[model samples]
Structure formats: C-alpha cells, structure tokens
Target chain A: MSFVDMLLRAEARHRSRLCVGLDPDPARLPGRWRGRVEHLYDFCAAIVDATADLVCAYKPQIAYFAAHGAEAQLERLMAHIRVVAPEVPIILDAKRGDIGSTAEQYAKEAFERYGADAVTLSPFMGFDSVEPYLRYPGKGVFLLCRTSNPGGDDLQAQRLADVPGQPRLYEHIAALAQGPWNRHGQMGLVVGATYPQEIERVRAIAPTVPLLIPGVGAQGGDAATTVRAGWRGDAAGHTTGPVIVNSSRAILYASTGDDFATAARAEAERTRAALWV
Target chain B: MSFVDMLLRAEARHRSRLCVGLDPDPARLPGRWRGRVEHLYDFCAAIVDATADLVCAYKPQIAYFAAHGAEAQLERLMAHIRVVAPEVPIILDAKRGDIGSTAEQYAKEAFERYGADAVTLSPFMGFDSVEPYLRYPGKGVFLLCRTSNPGGDDLQAQRLADVPGQPRLYEHIAALAQGPWNRHGQMGLVVGATYPQEIERVRAIAPTVPLLIPGVGAQGGDAATTVRAGWRGDAAGHTTGPVIVNSSRAILYASTGDDFATAARAEAERTRAALWV
Candidate 1:
C-alpha cells in the first residue's frame, strides 16, 4: 500500500491522529533504565506495547538510538513495533540529506535495514536527495516545512522572489510536494503543530497531502488549533486530508517510575483525545 | 583549536588541500572484500593508511556504513583514522538536521560517539539544529550551501525577496555563516566544486570561513577551478580562507583489484596534485 493509504488506514482503525514519538533519551529513561543504553529496545518496546492501539503511527527518532551505538537495539525495537502494532506505520525520524549514491544508501538504511514505513528527510539538498528514497515504491518522505523551532524562521519563513506569488520558502516546498513531487503521492510535509497558522497555510497550499505535525503536547502547541488548521475530513469524518500530530517527550517521559509504560499509555490516550477534538 | 585552525594546520602539514572521502560501497569494494559489509572498516582503514599523509582531511560518508548496519565499523574506522592520521581532521558527512533535544542526540552521535572533528549539516531546519553541535566547543559544522547535485537548484538557488538584495538561499547562508551565526569562528559552508561560479560567490560572501568543497573527482567537479574559486591564503602561504576539496568514488574505486589500496594512494596523489594546481 502507498504510505498515505496506510496512514489513513491506521487513523481509521485507531480513530486517532496521534503519533507517539519514540525518542528514548538515555538520561531520561525511567527507573532502572535511566542512563542505560542496553534497555533502549526494552523501554521503547514497552511503550509501543502500551500505546499500540492508541496511535495512528509511531515515530522512532534514530539519532537517540544511534547516539548510544544501539542501532541493533533499534532494529529490535522496529521489529517489536511491527509485531505489536501490525497495522500502525513506523516513521523513522532520520532527517538525512545527501546527494546521489549517498542518498541511496540512507534510503536503504531507513527502509531496508530498519523497516521504516516512512522516513523524514531534510529537503535542503533538493530532489536528488529525495529521489533515491521515492524509489521504495510505497514508503513516504516528510520534508520539513514550517518547523516549531524559532530558528526555523531563519530560512523557512523567508519570502522567495521570482516564484510567481512570492511564496515563503515553506509554502514553495508545499506547492512543489503537492504538484511536481507528488507523482507517486508518496510525499508529505512536516509542519509544526506549534505553528497552527503556518499549518493552515501549508494545508491551503497542499490540500490532499498528509501533514506530520510534531510539537502537540510538550512543545506548547495547542492541539485543537492544530487539528482545525491542518486536518480535513468528509462529513462522515472519514479523512479527506491526513494529519499525524506527534508527541515525543510528553508521552515518553510521562513518568520516570517502573509504571512508566502505563503513564505513557495514559498520555497517549489523552493526546489522541485532544487531537481528535 | 577551532576546526578551521585544525583544517589549516592539516593543510599546511600535508601540503595539499584534498580531502579523501571514505565512502566504501560494498558492491564496489576491491577484490576479496567485494560485497562484504564486515570489511567496511578494513577497506576504509586501508585507504586511510595508504593516503593519510597525502591529504588534509578524511570524510567518511555515514550513509555508506549505516546502510549495511555497520555503524560499529564506522566507529572503528573513525578510531583508525585518528590513530593513523591524527593530524588530518575527519569530517563526518552525516548532513543531519533536527530540532532541540533530537538535534542534541545527533550531535552526540557525531562528535562524542564517532569522535568526528567536524560534521556536515543540512541547514533546512535552521540554526536550532546547528546550535546543539556548536555547544561542543572546538568542534566544527559545515552547513550545506550550494551542493553539486542538480536538484540543489530547487530550493538553494532560489532568491529571497524579503531579504535585502534578494540574496539566493545559498548566498544568504554564506552571509550568515560569515556573520552572526559564526560567533565562535567554528562554522563553514559546503559548496560543491562542480559549480565553480557559485563557489566563487560563496567565497566572496564568506571570505575567511573554511569551505568544504566536495564533488571534485568522480562527480565531475574540476579541482583547479574549485581551488581558484574557494581557496585563499596570505603571502607566506599560511591560511587566510581555507578549503578542503573532497573526492570519494574515484579514489575509493580507482582499482577494483587486489592492489586497491595502492591504487587509492595513487588516485589521492593525483587528486591532491590537481587541487594544488
């Protein structure tokens, strides 16, 4: 299946757009797992088990695992996600950007080695960097659009001259992804939930493409506003345009006790409810 | 010492500006090592041993290693580079870009775990993604400016209307790297060698920051043009504006035979001589 179709299916099955981000910080691991790299798969798998039915997708930040030299454990966590949440898609949050053959290798690492359903990429290197990943027929690539960080304004918000309407950089990227780049409908944009206005703008530019909005819970973004701006549905509530509102730190670090998984489930449930609203 | 200082010291010590990119592809590995992921470290280390004294830096494309689940081998190769050629700086061609804590984890992966002297970053997410790496003093980051790939024109070559003079995206990055964003004098720009005019433009905008120019050999970028456009120095032949010209596939696969390392050295020597000219 195409990744968008898979995302919509997960959304329908779970009845939610919440994507629990699995960013396992070693310093922040719960209880005995704290500061221990060995428990990366264990902690992430437990969280996956707890929230498997509560989310549309799971985003595993590869850097967190790679930083600890625990890629094999990440491989295990990815497999664990597959077994636990068979229908839910996995977005490997590896914002990789390179050219030509190097890009091909990164695509392989994300799709072949890690079994990611979708992977994030920095669109800075343009379509050559993106083209390699698209060769993986059904996999998706999320280009960073209006990100949540203040520094995002440095480049993303700047107006592009000579492009007919003088669109902002993010708007231009949205238009490209919606038009020329969406030949396979396997492309998406990552617009921050914190920027609900920009989310609305991006939605206006790329109406049908899915939007992966992070920063809903812990990054001080208003969930209801984000959903209103980015999410689109038919009268029967079937998705017309998809949205994946991701919450990482808020869900993963909900509790630093042995019952951390349970706390994470509660957080995921609450986040899903909030995104639904 | 700052990364630029280290780059300059290495350049002067080696008497060449060439940076051999250690992008070891298993499919193209020489002779007995062909198509063997287990030999990633062995192939790269052999190349380093052969060319250590002939170059200013060694850049290992992480994607090549990560694709085969050989990040451990990458760690070992990094250690090998440090041991065999301690004077030559190592640039981790990760091109990683993310936000907040996620970006911090990526930085730790590059600087701490991998022991990279410098890292390449895609500036798509802006300064927040770059800031975490900057936190580690003495480390360096080379922002992707005007890449050699054709698709780079998609976003990088666009003009920013709102900004004064309507600077192209890459030129705006050059100004920032040469100005406010480079407070610690630790930032550089990655301008591809294929576009010598753009390299010259970047040099004009950021006269003193080190420029990591890739796309030299196998990618069809001219070494002499790249050198003339990007590199600058004072009368004593001491560094003023530094440049590290990179060539990957041409050097790594110069000979797909038993004497690959020796062939690699010859290619490195020819490339180094070309850059010097």
Candidate 2:
C-alpha cells in the first residue's frame, strides 16, 4: 500500500496522528534501562509496546542507535515494533542525502535493511539524491522543507529569484514536492511545528502531501497552533489530513524515574487528546 | 590540526590530490571476492593497500557497507586504512543531516565511531543539521553544493533572490559556507567535477575553502577540466589549494578480473598524474 493510504488506515484505527519519536538517549533512559545497548533496545521496545495503539507511527531516529554503535539494537527495536504493532508504520528518521549510487545504497539501508515504512531525506543535493528513495513505490520519503532549528533560517528561508513572486527556498521545495517529485504520490514535507507560519505556508503550497510536524512536545511548539496551521480539512470541513505530530523527549523521557513506560503512555495519550482540541 | 591543514599536509607529502573512493558494490567485486561480508572487507582493504600511497585521501561511502549489514567491515576497513596509510585522511561520505540532537548522533558516528578525518554533509535542513559536525574543529565538513548528477539542477540551480545579483541557490550556499557558518574554519564544499563552470564559480565564491571534487572517473567528468576549474592557486602562484579529485568505479573496478588491485593502483596513479596537468 502507498504510505498515505497506510497512514490513513493507521490514523483511522488509532484515531490519532501522533508519531512517537524513538530517540533513546542513554542518559535519559529509565533508571533500570540505562547504559547498555540491550537496555536501549528494551527501552525502545517498551515505548513501542506502551504507546503503539495510540500512535499513527513510530519514528526511530538513526543517530541515537548509531552513537552507541548499536545498530543491532535498532534492528531489534524495529523488529519488535513490527511484531507488536504491525499496522503502525516505522518512519526511520535518517535525514540522508547523497548523489546517484551512494543514495541508492542509503535507500537500501532504510527500506530493505531497516524495513522502514518511510525514511526522511535531505534535499540539498536536489532530485538525484532524492530520486533513489522514490524508486521504492511502497515507501514514503519526507523531504526536509522547514526544520525546527534556529539555524534552519540560515539557508531554508532564503528567497528564490527563479520562482515567480520570489518565494522562499522552502516554498520552492514544497512546489517541487507537490509537482514532479510526487509522481508516485509517496512524497511528504517536514515542516517544523515550532514555525507555525512556515508550516501554514508549506501547508498551502503542498496541500495534499503529508506533513511530518516535529518539535511539538519537548521543543516548546504549541500543539494547538500546530494543528491550527498544519491541520488540513477535508471538503466537508473534517480535519482528516495526514499530519503527523512528533514528540520525542517529552514522551520518551516523561519520567526518567521507574514509571517511565506508564508515564510515556500517559503523555502520548494526553498529547493525542490535546491535538484533538 | 584542522582538516585543511591535514589535507594540505597529506597532499604535499603524497604529491597528489586524488581521493580514491572505496565504494564496494558486491556485484562489481572481483571474481574471487564476490560474496560474503569478509570478502567485502578484503576487497576494500586490497583497494586501500594498492592505492594508499598514490592518493591524498580515501573516501568510503557508507551505503555500500550499510547495504550488506556490514558496518563492521567498514570499521575494519577504516582501521585498516589507519594502519596502512595513517597520513591519508578518511572522508566518510555519509551526507547525513538532521535537526539538533539527531545531527549530534550522526556526528558521533562519523567522527568517533568511524574515525573519519572528515565527513560530507547535506545542508538541506540548514545550519543546525550541519553545525553538530562542525563542533569538532579538527575534523572537516564538506557541504554538498553543485552536484554532478542531472537531477542536481532541480534545486541547486534555482536562482536565489537573497543575494545582490540574485545568484543561484548553490552560490548562496557557497557564500554561507565561506562566511558565518564556517566560524571554526573547518568548512568545505563538494562541487562536482562534471560541471567545471560550477566548480569554477564555487571556487571563486569560496576562495580558500577546500573543495571535494567528485564525478571524475566513473561519472564521465574530465580530469583536465576539473583541475583547471577546481585548482585554486595561492597569490604566489603555487598549487597549494585544497581540491581533491575523486575516482570511484574507474579506479575500483578497473579490471573486474584477477588483476583488480593492480589495475586499481594503475588507475589511481594515472588519475593522479592527470590531475597534475
């Protein structure tokens, strides 16, 4: 199935658009699940198990696993998620981009090796770096449009001259994603919830493309504003758009104490409830 | 020492500006070393051993190793490079980018775990994605600029209105790297050799910043044009500028027969000799 259809199905089943980011920092893991690589796996598995039913997808950031030299643990975590929550998608947040054959290898790594339903990519190298990921028709590729960092304005916010009316660089990217890049209908844009205005701009530009809105929970982005700006409504005025609001640290490290898993579930549930409002 | 200093030192010592890319495709491996993970290690080690003395650096593309689930092989290969050719730097061509914490993990992966002297980064997510890698002042960060691929034109070639004369997006990126973003002075740009004009343009934009010029051998980029456009000379007219010309398949799979390593060394030598002109 296409990512959008699968996402809609997951959204319908869970009645939520929450994407729990599986970023397991060793220092922030629960007391019992700290230090070791096995514990990392256990911690992420626990998070997935605790909140699988409440989320549309689980985003496992490749960096946390890579930092510990525990790719095996990541493999295990993804496997566990597949077994426990077969319906919920796995969006591997790699943010990888390269030219030609190297890009193809990354695609294989994310889709074939890691079994990600979707993989995040950087569009700096333009279409060549992204085209390899698009070869996988069943998979989804989220191109970074407007990120949730202060340094994001360093380049993404630059105004483009070639574009009519001189739209910003991110707007140009959104147009590309909505146009030629969406031939397979598997493309999405990552517009940060922290930048509601940019989110609103991107939403208007790429109307139908799914928006992976990060920075909602721990990053201090207001969930209500994110929903207001990012949430697209159907013709009948129902807010049924494919907008995934991700909360990593706020949900994962809800209580670094012993009640981490329960707290995570509670936070995820509360966040989902808040999104509805 | 910083990456530029180290790179220059290596270049002067080796008397070459060639960067041999160790992108090992399993199907393209020599007949004797076709399958198995150990063979991949052996293949890369042989390539390194054969061409180590003739090159300034070795760029190991992460995708090839990640595809086979053989990151251990990559680690071994990097370790082998250290043992055999300690003077030559290792450029881990990961092209990784992400927001904040995630970028930190990738930085760790490239610098600490892989022990790369430098890493290639995609600037799509802007400065935050590239900043983590820059924190290590001793290491080098080469931002992707005008890529050699046809699809690169889709975005990088778009003219930006932010600059005085409305320079292209790549030019804006070049200016950024040459200015504020390169505070530690460890920044560089990856401008493809296939587009000599773009390489020349980037060279002019960022005069002193090192350029990792790829697409030389296998990608049909001319070496003479690459050297002419990419090679920047000091005011004293010495070719001491940091411009690395990379050749992957042409040097790697030179024979694809029993004499693979020997052929690889010969091709590296030939490519190195060509760069001098």
Candidate 3:
C-alpha cells in the first residue's frame, strides 16, 4: 500500500494519531532492561504489546542501537516488534543523507534490511541523496524541516536573496520539497512540535505533505497545541490526512519501575487521547 | 597543537597547498589490490607512500570503505595511512551530523576509533552537532557549505526574513560560523570548486578559516582557478594559508594498470604542478 493509504488505514484501525518513538537510549533504559539485549528485546516487546492498539506506527532511531554495536541485535529486536505488533508500521528513523551510490546502500539497509514502512532523511545532501529511497513503491521519506533545537535558527533562519521572497531556510526547504521531487505523496516533513508557528507555516505551504511532528512530551511541547497547529487548516481541514504525532522519551521513559510497559501504555493512551481534543 | 597551527605548519613544511583525497572505489582499484580488507590496506598504504611528501593532508571518504561493511577495517586502513604518511593529516570525509549525544558518539568513532586528524560534518544538525567533535584539542571539523551538486540550489536558495537582507543559505551559514563558533580555530568549510563567487563571498567573511576545496580534477573543478581564488587580497596578493585541494577519483583512478601507484603519484604531481599556474 502507498504510505498515505497505509497511514489512513492505520489511523482508522488504531483510532489515534500517536506514533511511539523507540529511541532506546542505553543510559536511560530501565534497570531491568540494562546490560542485556534480551532484556531490551523483552522491554520493547512488552511495550509494543501494550501500546500497539493505541498507536499508528513505531519509530526506532538507529543511532541509539548502533552505539552499542547492536545492529544485528536490533535487527532481531525489530523482528520481535513485528511479531508482537504485526499490524503497526515501523519507521526506521535514521536521518541519513549521502551522495547517490551510498544513498542507495542506505536505502537497502533501511528498507530491505530492517523492513521499515518509512525512513527519515536529512536533505543536506540535496534531492539526489533522497531520490533513491523514494524509489521504493510504498515507503515514506520524512525530510528534516524546522527542528526543535534552540540553535536551529542558526542556519535554518538564514535568507537567500536568489529566491526573491519567502525568507527562512526551513520555509525554502518546505517549498521545494512539496513538488516534483516528492511526487509520490509518500514524502513527509519533520516539523518539531515545539515550533507551532513554523509548523503552521509549513503546513500552509505543503498542505498535502504529511508532517511527522516530534518533540511532543519530553520536549515540553503540548500534544493538544501541536495537533491544532498541525491539523488545523491542514488542506481544507481534511484533518486526518497529513500529520503523525511522535513522542519518544515521554512514553518510553515513563517509569523506572518494573511496570515500565504498563507506564508506557498509559502514557501512550494519554497521548493518543489528546488527539481528539 | 590547534588545527589552525597544524595547517600553518603543514603549509610551511610542505611548501605546497595540496590535500589528496583517498576514495578507493573497488572497481577502480588496480589488479593487484582488487578485493578484501588486506588489498584495501595495501592500496591505501601505497598511495600514502607515493604522495605523502607533496601533500598537507590525506582525506579518506568513509563511504567507500563503509559500503563494503569495512567499518571495522577503517582502523587497519588508518593505521596503514598513518604509518606511510604520519606527518600528513588524515581527514575522514564522513559528513556526519546528528543530535549532541549522537554527535559525541560519532566524534568518538572518528577521533578515538579511526584516529582521523579531522572529520567533515553536515551543518543541518546546527552547531550543537559540531561541538562534540570540536571539543578535542587538535582535531578539525569541516562543515559542508556550497556543495558541488546540481540540485543544491533547491532549499539552499531559500530567503529568510528574520536575518534581514536575505543571503543565500551558505553565506548565512558562513557569517554565523565565522564568529562565536570559532572554537580552537579548528573549524573549516567545504566550499565546492564549482561555486567560485560563493567561495569568494564566504572567504571574505571567514578569511582566517581554512577551506577544504573538493571537485577539482574528477568533478570538473579546475585547480588553477581554485588556487587563484584561495589567494587572499593582501598587499602582495599572497596567501600564506593553504586551501586544501582535493582530487579523489582523478588521483586514485589515474590508471587501472598494474603500476597504479606510480600513475597515481604522477597524477598527484601533475595536480600539484597546476597550482603554480
């Protein structure tokens, strides 16, 4: 299925816009899940078991696993996630962007190796860096737009006179990404929830383009505000089409207690409930 | 010593401004050094031995090695390069950029694991992404600016209103990077040879910053024009500083013949000789 159609189906089935971000930070992992890949697997499996019904997708940031040389182990973990939550989509969040040939290799790794439904991309290497990944029939490529970091404005706010009007670098990226480069309707923008105004601005321009909204909970971005900024005026208020709300630490690190999976599920439930408001 | 001081010292010692790029494509390797990690080691060692005397630094683009699942083999290759060309700096041309924590891990891998003198970074992650790599005293961080790709103008050409008087994205990056972020003087920018005007504009603002100019021989960028562009407008129109000229495929693939090292050295010599024009 196309990313849009899959997203629509998943949202309808789950009845939620929430997408849990599985940024498995080793340092922050619960005590029971520490020092063992098996434990990590169990923790992730339990979380998936508890929250799959509440979320449309799961995002696993690759860096956290690769830090521990857990590439092969994480492959196993993802397999377990698939078995546990067979219906939910997996977004392998590796913000990779490189020259042409190398990008093809990365595409193979993300889609063929991990079997992810979508992959995040860093557009710094230009469209050629992303084109190979977009070649996959139904896979989604979420390009980095206005990020949540305080220093984001450092380069992102820079204006180019060559384009005549429309300042901010992020706006420029949004403008170009909406067109010929991303024709499949599978392309998405990562608009941080912390920057509601910019989210609204990006949403205005790239109306059909799905926005992967991160920074919702642990980053102090209110979920309700983010949904409004993202879904409001989103292409004639066809509210369901173009936004997937993401929460990482807030859900994953809900408790250091052994009932961590239960805590994670509650956080996911609360986050999912916020979508209706 | 600081990276700037190292560059100055290299310029004085070598009496040349050349930095050779080591991008070993398997298809381009000579018959003798065709496959396996051992072949890569021998090939890289030969290049280092042949050209170390005439160059300021040697850059090994990590992608070429990394594509072969040779991530572990990089240490061995770096060892070979260092043994052959100890004094000449080694810049691992991995354009890595991520969040602060992830950047720290990449820094560890580049500095601690591979022992590269410098590493390239993508500025998309903001200054925080560059900080971890810059924290080390003697290491260099080359930020991507004005890339050599054709589709580079898409988002890089966006104009932002907040910065007042919209500058092309690269110019704005150069302006911000010039001042507060000039930690240890280890910062350099990757200005492609194709954009001479942008190069001049960036150079005027960041006069002290060293530049790693790629796209010379193989990528159709002329060395003579680049050298002339590197000349700071002093009273004598002389630049004591060196602009690291990079030639990857042109040097590495000088010949598919058995005496590839000899041909490679000849190419390096011819490339260096062109700077005088």
Q: Each candidate: fraction of true contacts kept?
A: 0.92, 0.80, 0.35
* lDDT, model 3: 0.77
Whole-structure CA lDDT of model 1: 0.90
Question: Model 3: residues >4 Å from true position, as ranges?
Answer: A32-50, A159-167, A232-240, B27-46, B65-68, B157-165, B233-241
For model 2, how does the per-residue alpha-carbon lDDT over A1-277 read when each residue is reduced to its tens digit?
Answer: 7778888899889988899999998877788766665688989998898998999889999889987789999998999998999999889998887867888889999999999999998887778788888899879999999887887887788887777988988898999999888867889989888878888899888888899999999999998789889876668876534789999999999998889999999999999988764
CAPRI grade of model 1 = high
Winner of 1 and 2 under lDDT:
1
Q: Candidate 1 on B195-265: residue-level lDDT in tens?
A: 78999899999998889998888899888988998866679975447888999899999999988889999
Rate residue B8 of model 2 by lDDT. 83
Model 1 / residue B205 / CA error / Å: 0.6
| lDDT, candidate 2, at A21 | 95
Candidate scoring better on lDDT of 1 and 3: 1
Q: For each candidate, what TM-score against the reference?
A: 0.98, 0.97, 0.88
Candidate 3 lDDT, B1-277, residue by residue in tens: 6666666676667766778887766666788566554566567768878887778788887766644555555678788776776667788887877776667767877887778888888888688878888889888888887777776666554544556665667766676667787787788888888867777777887777788898899889888888777556468776534588888888888888788889989998888888644
Best by lDDT: 1
Candidate 1 lDDT over A151-178, as tens digits, reads 9999999999989999999999999899
- Which 10 residues in a row give candidate 1 chain A its minimum summed lDDT? A231-240
* Ordered list by TM-score, greatest first: 1, 2, 3
Residues A86-175, model 3: lDDT tens digits: 777788887877766667767877887778889888888688888989889989999988888776767766655556574567777787
